[model samples]
Target: MPDTLRLVTFNIAHGRGLSLYQKFSSPERIRKNLRAIGELMVKVDADIVAMQEVDEDSHWNWNINLLKEIQAVAGYEYAELGVNNRRTGKRPLAYGNAILSRHRLEHWHTQSFGEATLGEKGFLYAEIDYKGQVVPLLNAHLDFRSRKRRVEQVESIMDYIIENAHRGPDERPLAPIICGDFNSRSKPQADAVNHLFQHILKHREYHLYPRDKRTFPAHLPSKTIDFVFLPEPYRMTRCEVLPGFLSDHKPVLLEFEL
Candidate 1:
């Protein structure tokens, strides 16, 4: 194993390209768009990829398993989908956050903010085994519309971390490397990103990367809603926003030393 780990967190807009609505895209077109994203992943050569808004058997995306499509080209050894929303029948739907890793993923868990099967946001937690090292990772997507809800969601995630910290299957579970589309800005004093970072600071120093790099609205980004919160023992070597039009939100990459 190398001294550093490279990871990328991206919201692929359900593999619908830059379109505002996924319903307008044909199944084949969506597949092609997703393959292009996979190509980007190959170029980035990240050890682990965390994704939000990925689909699996979703009607809007033509019932395509978006993770498999990406893995087909990206070629990760292990892939797991954490479905936060799932609806069946005429308008079937299933989509959420996912992780693709070159290492093994174990003890996977998923949670949703609400019981509603559509448009619900949540997170995925997993313990990844890289050689003999065990790393705890959380891939999250908070409420995009409400500040209060985003804060509440952050609280829930913190609680989850506290509850699992000691009882985890791993003998030595490192502090989580939390990454994803937080949906809340890092400014104005009360945003979810700052809120989560402050909570983590109680125990040890945590670093939030790509400090001022805007990621949303890829073409003309106004604010950054994507980030990686890495705790102590893992030092950030480099963090940057990658250029791409694969999704409405550009991907953020983090290279860190464990």
Candidate 2:
């Protein structure tokens, strides 16, 4: 029998729940929002979850570890945070992408696109052992404003994968499973998501999920800016854009067997 897994990628807007910004919300409000997000995570029941714009020990969010709060409620045994933005002073702020999993995560690493103290973007890479099979996974958040920068960030991601995710061909059988807030459309040959998808196809065939699902502005979505990319061997069993106003962006859930 093959093992099956569920995964979700969501940009949580730092747990503000449709608020304009974190600064406008109080610490208690942020915590309340996060608890609701945790409840959603439980309802989804994903084996591995990718999250963007997660905060930690930031004055704006009342020095709360957002991931921990979610994990506390959802009860995930393993979690890792890739802090892409870090600044310390009278008013400290730190946040980035993160992953929570039911399986053990190993050899995890984080890479940022730039050195900006805030609004920086990046990805987290890790190799997970599932039922004795080694699967490489990445959780990323790319630039949302500039198309050129998003493409550049994709290039960096590809380069990193080529350099780090290799062992002997016989030992490494599966390509990495990537999920994130790409901030670009899946159409148009020139788009960042397609660019990365096309580039990886040079080596092995891959599939992009929720191709027609619009995930942004959860209450009234009109664009698809989040996705999950998996190699051909992993057969997708189910895919759905979850409904809710958990954040500005909706969560995409994908179920697969390997």
Candidate 3:
């Protein structure tokens, strides 16, 4: 039986604005960027795509219903958009995380992970009903200002899963397959993703449990920050970084078997 899943996570940087290296704000340039992102996702062929920084506001065309547009380009029917930047003033912007799936969804919830209101972050928790079983997939984007804040967000996420995974009202939580843009850029944060692996193989309960890890500089990824954390039951088949595209950060894909 083909009982495997391909999941992808990328902080598409939505309408945040151009990089410091980019000075001129050209529509063609932005469209090119979006097109670039869409093309990459099409090739990845992930069963589920979790994207951050997608625009849902109307201030700029770059922010115009980006999740939907991208989905249309990728040809995925099922999708979920969790709006983190709620409407505040004439600028009713709502760019958060998005989860796209080809499988039938059993349950869905939009979760916030920011400890404070610095730069709000969210996660798209979804249950994929494949072959008569439920598998939970989480797509998240953590804060980037401080390491402490990011670590707190990670802790909250882990706690939420372990405590409330199987307690959703309308859906059953099979297992959490977490993947996203975790802006932790240090040794402490990098090792935190492998908590159970470290415990089992390295014989330690935890290492680098409270540190920030960075996953930027995809072409020359010096520090591993982005991740697709597979728990005990889930097995990782492949992991790779797709860098230097539309988004400031690189896109990551994880192939695994359920």
Candidate 4:
């Protein structure tokens, strides 16, 4: 059954538009949340866009390149940027996590993950084709005040994508789609699941938040921690949590059936 794609995951908190603050130091609230993140990606037409806290200032010279101005206000003609903080003083402090595509990006990769409690956490891999089939996208950002450091950075990003699994492209049949901003969607019962943290329990595999609800207060999102995952045989028709207001998480959409 392969043919259905509509994905989105956001953490535009560093477009600094209207100031979600990540040290842009405020220029009239980064000119109103960088124009409310280009009207929140054109009201979420997202066919693929997993972003999180982006910035690129080698040293605060500021030329305003908030990920090409939110992909030219959500026009997304295919993009990729996964720097995960690269500061070099006089003008080279880059931020990270961004993977966009209206389908056509054929290869990409980036690493840098950790039990990292709060700084550089990245993973933005891509290899899309969309209109003609072929997929595998991941853009993540986890580590919000430790849960065993988000279980060793989600088990070192699923053991580095299951031990490289052929480095993607060439035959592309993985069809994975793991989105972002998962500050651990609530699981503090302690119990005995930390068997060094394996992850495969959120409804036994993957299919998150809709009944699990909540996506971090855009005004009142109790707490869902933003996510979207699908692998093996692809199949998820609706996964929502998008009311939106600029940040503090509120963007997740998936359709996938590919």
lDDT of 2 by residue, 1-258 (tens): 778899999999998889988878898898898998888888878888899999987887778899999999899998999999999999988999999988888679999999999889999998877866777889999998999999999999999988887463586545799999999989967879999999999877899999788999788999998999988788999999999887999999999998
Model 2, position 122: C-alpha lDDT score: 99
- C-alpha-based local distance difference test score of model 1: 0.90
Q: Clashing residue pairs, candidate 3?
A: 184-212, 184-213, 184-214, 185-212, 185-213, 185-214, 186-213, 214-225, 215-225
In the range 1-258, model 3's lDDT, one tens digit per residue, is: 547887777787663334543224455665667666666778878788888877676454534677777777788888888877665565455668888888888788887764332258878788887777677778878777766666666677766766667543555444577777776543462433443233323321222211233346644456655676666466666776665646567677777777
What are the per-residue Cα lDDT tens digits for candidate 1 across 1-258?
548889999999999989888989998889899999889989988999999999998888888999999999989999999999999999999999999999998678999988889889999999888766778899999988888989999999999988786333555445798999999888756979989989988866788887879999998999899999998888888898999799999999999987
lDDT scores of the candidates, listed in order = 0.90, 0.89, 0.65, 0.66
Question: Residue 38 in candidate 3 has what lDDT?
Answer: 67
lDDT of 4 at 196: 18
- Candidate 2 collision pairs: none
Question: Using TM-score as the measure, what is the rank order of every candidate, best first?
Answer: 2, 1, 3, 4
Candidate 4 TM-score, C-alpha based:
0.31
Error of 2 at 162 (Å): 0.4
Model 1 regions more than 4 Å off = 166-173
